[model samples]
Target: EPEVTQTPSHQVTQMGQEVILRCVPISNHLYFYWYRQILGQKVEFLVSFYNNEISEKSEIFDDQFSVERPDGSNFTLKIRSTKLEDSAMYFCASSGAGNYGYTFGSGTRLTVV
Candidate 1:
């Protein structure tokens, strides 16, 4: 079965640096989303993009963050300026149908020093 795949399972970065997390969402899906989970915190939705446009975004998606579908299978999240608070597990998810369960990638653990 097709599954979402993420690279660099764990990343360590310094504050005020830049990082790009990569993901390959399940093929044939239309909607893609990014979520972050802080240690001992609930998963928070960051953004959802579809048809090359942002469908919905949370307040957490600020100016420092951006996302792109650089190719047919790759979706990436870029943080232009990282902060200590950015340390978390970033999850990439996709769903064929809205209101259904999402298929999440194992996640990229980003740790900012």
Candidate 2:
């Protein structure tokens, strides 16, 4: 079965540093999303991308965050600067038809010190 893949399953970074989280979504999927779970909080949507463009983004996805599909198969999320509050499990998800049938990566746990 096809599945989303994330790299560096765990990352520890200092505050003010930059980090790029990588993902390879299912090849057949058309929509991609970046979501984060801050510790005990519910999953929060950060951004959605399709056709190599950002379709929607949440308030939490400010200038510090960026998403890109650098190649046909690779999707990435970059944080301009790390913050303690930024620590969380970042999930990469993709859907074949818009908002349905999503397949999520195991997730990359980022710990910002």
* TM-score of every prediction relative to native: 0.96, 0.97
Q: Give model 2's clash tally.
A: 0
- Candidate 2 lDDT by residue in tens digits, 2-72: 88999989999999999999999999899999999998899999999999999999999999999999999
Model 1: number of backbone collisions: 0
Best by lDDT: 2
Off by over 4 Å in 1: none
Q: What lDDT would each prediction earn against the true structure? A: 0.95, 0.95
lDDT of 2: 0.95
Cα displacement (angstroms), candidate 1, residue 22, comes to 0.4
| C-alpha RMSD of each candidate structure in angstroms | 0.9, 0.9
lDDT by residue (17-58, candidate 1, tens digit) is 999999999998899999999999999999999998789999
TM-score, prediction 1: 0.96
